[model samples]
Target chain A: MKTIWFHLMPYPELPDDFTDEHRSVWVDIDPALFDARVGHRMYNEYIDELEFAASVGFDGVGINEHHSNAYGLMPSPNLIAAALARTCPDAALVVLGDSVALYNPPIRVAEEFAMLDCISGGRLVAGFPVGTPMDTLYAYGNNPATLRERYHEGIELILKAWTADDVFSFNGKYSKLRYVNCWPRPAQKPHPPIWIPGGGSVDTWEWCARVGYSYLYLSYFGYKAALKTMQGFWKCVEDAGRPANPFQAGFAQFFGVADSEAEAIELYREPAEYFFNRCLHVYPGFADPPGYKTLNTVRNGAEGMVERAAREANERAAQAAKKAERKAAQQSFSAASHMSFEQMVEKGYVIVGNPDQVAEKTVEMAKQLRIGHVMSLCHFGNMSRDLAMHNTELMATKVLPQIRHLWDDEWEDEWWPQPLPASDRVMPSPRPTVSR
Target chain B: MIDLAQWKAGSLEIWREGEGRTVGYLHGMVCAPGRQPFVTELASRGFEVVAPSLPGYSRTAPSDDIRNIHDWVFALSEIIDVAGLAGAPMVASSTGAMLALELAAVRPEAFSSLVLVAPLGLWRDDLPVADPFSTTLSGQRALLTKDPTTTALFFEDHESGDALVDATIQRYTARTATASLVWPLPEFGLSQRIHRVSCPVTLVWGSDDQIIDPSYADSFAACLRDVRGRHVVNGAGHLAEWDDPSAVASIAASALN
Candidate 1:
């Protein structure tokens, strides 16, 4: 099995009374709360952790996009991925990805991604996400009615721009380029392996299946809750008559492995609580706009639609229920946040315990879902840099080596990043290693 | 009566009433209010009103041919042409008025005159219009009308079975089509082309209209080359006709005459 370390890079110093004092942590979040000086240090610390994970023998290190939110500070994942490409040579510099729809011409994405692949010596995993409506529709000013249409159009334009051999005049519904030429074609022939990060939309599932791309579901809502979606994707693959190669799917989970269960709980409990309770306190209204969800998705009661359907139920009870949930952090933290250490472990929201326990639970999770890639989120919320470093080393030394051989003999990973041929590879200066 | 008009790949619902000189009626962000008391009053005033579904709205499945604002103008112009209102005086409300303003600007030969009510086309930085796309039901209801009771003219609840799905799809698709025009912001540069509208234009707004403020009435009038004057109906909101049927219908009657 291929395991990667994904970082969300959350801002952890929010006031204790954040739930009461703040309306939300996204889109309309108070800019006054963010300090540039603190951000400078936090960013460096985050990049260091990602590089550290790559150097310590993890197969890959990942980063993703979020916008106008404190939950994930990296709005532009490309900027961070470029820095990672320069610093970390060996690991898959998984840009778990850019919201391809946000770019105007979207060829800009093709251009930038091509440059990143070249810089990384062909070690880029292009992640195309439709993006949350909060980022795409409201924050980015995309019309929700035509959001998907524009997104599909953007993807079409990008794929064509990347692989087209000749410069041609292209006319798209959203973008029109008189001379279509993508300078500096990708290092990987055709393009980098496309990974789609979705929130369980059936359209996204069938799309990824049909296109032979990996559907990486990154959820703060742990593996137990995520089972519904994982099953849905597996079903799509089965229905499509495609092989259920574990490499075709990836799932992200929070973890803290230690020498003992007590030590693991003590180390991870705070950050786990912080991520679920504070980082995820987005305003319900900002998450969905009119026509943001497709009618099919809405009818099917997909992951994103439940919140919208509840808010728009036209019943006073439903409105009050939504309002109550939004206002009270305690209500959600207990039910889904699983803040208590035992609850977190029981729910499989966070795999925190001794190395044996962590590895056992993680392997079981992968085998049950038939997920080939397990994306571990080791650094989350506001764990101190020193502790984050310790967590990375422990997970690398004690946990990863134990489970790296699970599915290797049976299934080939076609979705993993292909290393450049030795002649073209530009290896970064190897970081001095701590004894493995 | 409301009936489906199948043409090409799109199926449009056309509502026609009364008998006389045809009035090319344009609906706003909401579905056709059917033969509501306001539409009924307008019909009783002796005029055949033709309100066809805008492209990709109501029962009219969206077409690939219609993409942007210009595409919308072209498709709507085709509908107007097919309805045989080649040079009819038009009555349009809310976003419908926004489209009518564009059409009249593009092809002034097709429209004889225009009565735009609570039209939302002009952008105001200081007096930014309330966005209906993101708001909840109650919040949207508040912005659109002063009295929630007036919303009965738009939302016919207590629907059962087939009628229930029909009502839900009606509201869902209406907003979907509306967001294509007014979302993010209602500023599609109609101000730059409002001067090109050759026909005499009358702007009517509700005094208490919360959606598109009444102050925008003058802002829209300021950009037009020709103006037949502006009127504000008391005790009305953005859907001024629904709130004050008599006042809006009377003003529209005078403008059309």
Candidate 2:
């Protein structure tokens, strides 16, 4: 099984002088302060870390996109992936994908992906996601009604642009292009492998299965929640009668390793809460914009989550009906909910333990699910660079090799790089000699 | 000849009228009978103006199901298709301004021009305007009317009694109002897509509008590459048409040319 590290690299300090109590009050954070201080450091550190992951023997490094939030600073994962392409020689730079519908001329995605593929020597796994409703409908202001249509159209145009040797014209309901030609055509003939990261949309699962694209179930909620989504994906694949290409399916999970399970749990607890409580504090209205309102997000089950949060808030409000009582309860809730490591493990939000235990549990999960790719997020919300590096080294040296041996060692060359013609290849120029 | 009549779009009854030189009307939340006067004023200027009752307002049936701005656009498009005025200009006011902009983005060829009057979708974090519908009739009157005396005169012309005024205020403050405010606007990336619009656009603003600042007009004008012109009526609040009918009519007439 190929091991990929997904890093969010959350900021340590929040600009609001407000305590954790204040931060927990509302989800909508001001981006002005977030961008001013830690943004540049976070970007540089994340790049360096991912590049280091390549050197340390991780097969791939994952970068994802999110907008207007401090939780995930990478609004443009492609930009990070391009930088990774230059820095990491051997590791696959996975742009866990672009939100295709957001781009006006999604051909820009095609061109950029192609350029990245060439630059990385065909080590690009292009991920196209139908984006979250908050990002696509609220942030970007796309009509929810036309989102699926627009996404499919954008994907078709991108694919055609990548593969077609000659220029072509497309006139779709949303996008119309006079000429379709993407320069720096991907080094991988017929374009790089396409991965569709779905947020449990039925239409998306069926579409990915039909189109022969890899389906990645990003584990946002607990493992049990992710299990149902992954089961649905596998069922779709089975129903379609598509051969299980090992590379055609993957899963991402948060992981933290320490000297012991107790310590590991303690280390990951706050970060997991930060990801869920802080990062996922999207405005309720923004979750399912009217036109793009789906049964999954709008139905009773989906509405329950918001209702639960609101109910909790209401209860807190009622307890605080008197200013003094409210203040006392707020203080108690703040102190009590500091998020211990054991709770995070129980929540299934993270895999935290010694290297041996983590490795064993990871292998058990993969074997049980029969998944080929295990994407681990070792560096998450507000984790220090040194700590992340320690975790990465442990994962590379102790955990990965053990799990790797579990898979068939016959050297499956299906995902291996194909040989390029001498005329098509460009050798690196010699470095300039410097006086030391 | 332009046919003027009320028709049904799905579950909602739309007060759609006009044919040859078509203009779609988006009435404000608390619009009353006098709202038709703006339609008449536009009609007199040699243009067909169809002011459809927003889902819960006026003769239009109230819809608990309508969730977002695009749903309103779908209803608007159905009216345009039914009336065979698919290739007509739209003059949307307040909330309707957002709907009109969405329609233009979704189907750019449907209209020749879009006239948005004090549109409400753009919200800046720094603005001091509290919720427009939170106040009492008198409080709302103070906020919406640029001049208190002029506002009293306008209300005297429209509001028959305390009962009618209260009912109007209640209708405007229902769950529908909350839905309109909460429903996410289309992220057509219109700021970028505006340049792709094949038709002309005209933004009409009340110079003293408190709901949305006139400063926003510059951004709108800058983004809309095909804007024919922008006219700001003086001494008007958010509802420019009601404040100065002649000025709004003249702006509509200018766009027709």
Candidate 3:
């Protein structure tokens, strides 16, 4: 059995200067508040933290992509991955992906991945994603009908471009390429490890199993939702009669660690609210594009989404009706309608506690879901830079080491890179010793 | 000859050589001959129109499951591919506008130009309206019509009784509107990717549109890098084509020419 690999990706916080009373309104926030100089500084600081994670023995550092949204400012994870490739010596630079469907000629992805692999000396974990329906169809204007086809087509092109030795001409339903020759082939033999991130899509699980790619389940809901999806994935694997490779399966969750469970929960309450209440306010229209509808979306169903929006709409209407009914009635309703923190905790959308409690719960989840890798969002919501760093450091120093003993013999160490050759290695500058 | 009435009644109807052109029209949510005039008028203007009822909309049988945007795109793309009109310009209004824009963006080689009228997918946070589908007919009516006077305009020519039409509108609105709200916004970030669209795009807005704001026109123009032109028609709201058909048709003609 392999030791569990823990990865942390921090969402850089927006400047404190920006404020919106109608923050719940459209997903727009003033971009002017973002100091470009500070952004550059923060970028360097974020990379330094990820590097520190590697120095402290984290298996990997993660990065993801989002567009025109204030929540996650990284619209291009590849740029971040490139920077990390130089800073982090041991950790795998996981670009949880460049959405294949969004790219015009996905060959650019192949070329970029190859370049990253070369620069990192073979420490790149390439992620190809189908992307969320809202992002693919509404955001990118990709035809919903051709989304799956184009995505699969892009992947085929990317894989061929990565592994092929000869120039290739390819024509497909969505993309056509002539003489697809990519330079700087990946440092890894068949190509860098491929991971496909999905939100409970059946086709994605089946395809990942068939191709021997790692299936990373990104569970924004909670552990319970993720457990069901991972179980479904394993069943798919069993149905296919493929060996259950623990290394090939992973899951991610939002986590925060502190001195005590009470302190952690208290510290995380506001940021968690920012993530769920504030960041989750996507207009319903952008979620479902034409063509991108998969069976899973149908299964997870629109009724829930519809009901939530309808309920919210109805509640507003009812509130307005109440006001019209009587001002006193409106006051009574407003006074009565307050959601407590305990109610939110019961919902299981966020988990905050000390390292011991977080580790215990995480291990319990891993055991239940059979997940080998856990991508922890230690830095989330509007968590301050200092708080995020503290959480990351705490997870590294305490939580991970505690869990390490549990799965130490599970996986072989052969997967990790060997010591660099003398000619390829560079020694760090020595520091003078000081006696205090 | 394609019988406009039959076509509107949910049959597969194709007409070639009428006004020296061929066109297709997929009726909105419910299959009704009354909507055929919208397609026929476009044909009269020397343009081929193609509109197929979606699986759960109009006279077409509802699919076993309500599919995502991909299903509609695939159906439309197949229709365009088979018709050999891959190079023809398309005009899509209201809900259809989203599909038209997506088709043009995804497979630009198949289209010469795209015209979107009061298109969906431009939800602003500041808007006070509720999703048309999530609410009741009366609730939606209140949000959509600025005043009670304008509310009567929707029923003026509708032969369907006010009650029946209102029910149909609610169901259609709820289904599509609910579908939109279920997915994440970044998934619809085509505003940034509109630059990748190779074909010309012309966005038309109804000046008094109560459902979607005219200000969205600026956002659309900013996002769609290849826009040919944008026009805002006065005295028109969400259904500018029906509210002021002549103006809408003229703008479509200009874009086509």
Candidate 4:
């Protein structure tokens, strides 16, 4: 199993009364609340953390994009990826990733990803996300009805730009280009390993399966809640007649480990609360826009194909009752914002224990979910640098070694990044001292 | 209630009744044209009311070609011509009023006269239009009218009990159509083109309109080429026709006459 240290890089200085006073944490989040000097310090500290994670034997280091958001400071993950490509020499540069539909032409993504792959010596895992409603529809003002269409077209355009041998002319509904040629081709022959980080959209699952891309379920809710979505994805993979390779899927989980169970809880409780309560306190209005979810999703149960199939198994009279229960279960993540820490623990929102125990539980959950990759968010919310480092060091030194040998012998891990050896890697010459 | 009338662009569910001169009606942001009480009131007031549910507002499938405001204007103009109410006196409301004015600006003789209620074609940075799409359904109901109860026609389950999904899709398609034209902000440069409308326009506003301020009436009046009159009905909100259909019908009848 491969582990990636993922950071949301949230602002740490929101006042105690932020959730009460502000209407939302995104889109129309107050500009006055963000302090530039603090941001400058946070950016440097966050990058240092990612670099530290890479040095400590983590397989990959990751960052993501979010716009007009207080929780995620990264509006451009590519900039962070560029910085990491030079600094984190031993780690995969995972940008999980750019919202392709948000770009005007979307060739911007192809060019940038190719550039990152080249700079990182082919250790790049490209992530394409359709994006949240707040980021895509409200903040960027993309049409909700047409966002998915643009995303589909944008991916098509980007793939052709990367793989096509000759320059081509492209005509599309959302974008048109007279000349379509990417200057710096990716170091990876076909393209970088494509990972789609998605929410529970049925169409997204089927698309990822059909195209042979690894599906990364980036959910805040823990493995228990994620089981349903991952099950639906595996069903799609089965229906597509593809090999049920564990490496074809990835799951993100927030974990806290220490010397003892009590110590782990004490250390992680505040940051966990901060993340669930304050960071996730988005306005309900920004959650779902008209046409954001497809008509098919609306017609089927909100949980998508799995729920529909489950409903069909039950007697017709009992389906409605089961649906009402499912609806409450879906709200469990948002309800975490108001829940007690013990409640969160019992419900599996965050996995907390000693290093050995955490390792044991993680392996168990990974096997049950049939996934090989874990994007571990060890540092979350307003967790301090010292605490974050301790957590990372513990997870790297003790936990990772225990889980490392899980699927290595049974199946080939094909989705991991393949970096060029140091002998073949290119390094720019140092700048010469200027003479007067 | 008449079945949907087919046109070149798509099928439109229309409300057509009564006899005498034709009076075309276009609905506001809340519901389709026929769903509102004013359509029936106007039809009963001794005139033929030709009110077609704009494309995507009813069961008719939205065309992929209709992507922007220009396409909306062209499609709406074509609907009026196909429905055979091209030269009739028209009464339009809110979002419909915005489209009607756009059509009138480009094709002067499309309507003999126009009665526009709380049209949404202008923007004031300080007095911004309340975003109907960004709030809860109940909150949106409160913005659309002074009394939230009047919005049951929009939120209440349809008569077909098992067709809940179908009703949700209807509302979503209607919202998609409106948001395509008015989202982020409702202004689409109609202030610059208001001078081109040759037909006489009578403006109406709900005194308590929260979506677009009642004061915006003066803003529209200042730019229009020919403003016959401006009237504000008392005890009403943004969808004034829903609040007091009799008063809106009476005002519209007087304007048409």
Per-residue C-alpha lDDT of model 2 across residues A1-436, encoded as one tens digit per residue: 8888887655656532323334322234554455554677877787778988888999889888766556666678888888888777777777878999998889988988888888877888888988765567556756555566788889999989888879989997678889887897988888788888766666566777788787777755546446666676778788899765555677887788888877876666766666554444433333433334343333212332222333343344344455445455545443343344466577666877899998888887776565677778888767777878888888898889888865566334244334245566554567999999
For model 1, the superposed segments whose C-alpha errors exceed 4 Å read: A305-346, A429-436, B31-33, B152-170
Candidates in order, TM-scores: namely 0.91, 0.66, 0.65, 0.92
Interface RMSD of each: 1.8, 10.0, 8.8, 1.3
Output the number of the lDDT-best candidate: 4
Q: State the lDDT of candidate 3 residue by residue for B1-257, as single tens digits.
A: 43222222133333332353333332222123224445656767886665544443433433322235665566557656554557777666666666666666677776777777767655567763233432344444554433333344332344556656544443443344334422333135456446667878888888877666778777777777688989998877665665566677788877877
- DockQ head-to-head 1 vs 2, winner: 1
RMSD of each: 4.4, 10.4, 9.9, 5.7
Per-residue lDDT tens digits for candidate 3, residues A138-176, read: 456555544677788899998899888799898866668
Model 2 RMSD in angstroms: 10.4
Task: Tell me the TM-score that candidate 1 gets on chain A alone.
Answer: 0.91
Clashing pairs in 1: A246-A372
- Best candidate, TM-score: 4
| lDDT per residue as tens, model 1, A292-403 | 7776665565756325322322233344456668886445322332245566568787888888888888888888778888889999888988888788888889888889
The per-model lDDT (C-alpha) reads 0.80, 0.66, 0.62, 0.84
Poorly placed runs, candidate 2 (over 4 Å): A15-28, A35-37, A244-246, A266-285, A293-333, A336-338, A405-430, B1-257
For every candidate, give the share of true A-B contacts it also has.
0.67, 0.06, 0.00, 0.49
The worst-scoring run of ten residues by lDDT in candidate 1 chain A lies at A308-317
Ranking by DockQ: 1, 4, 3, 2
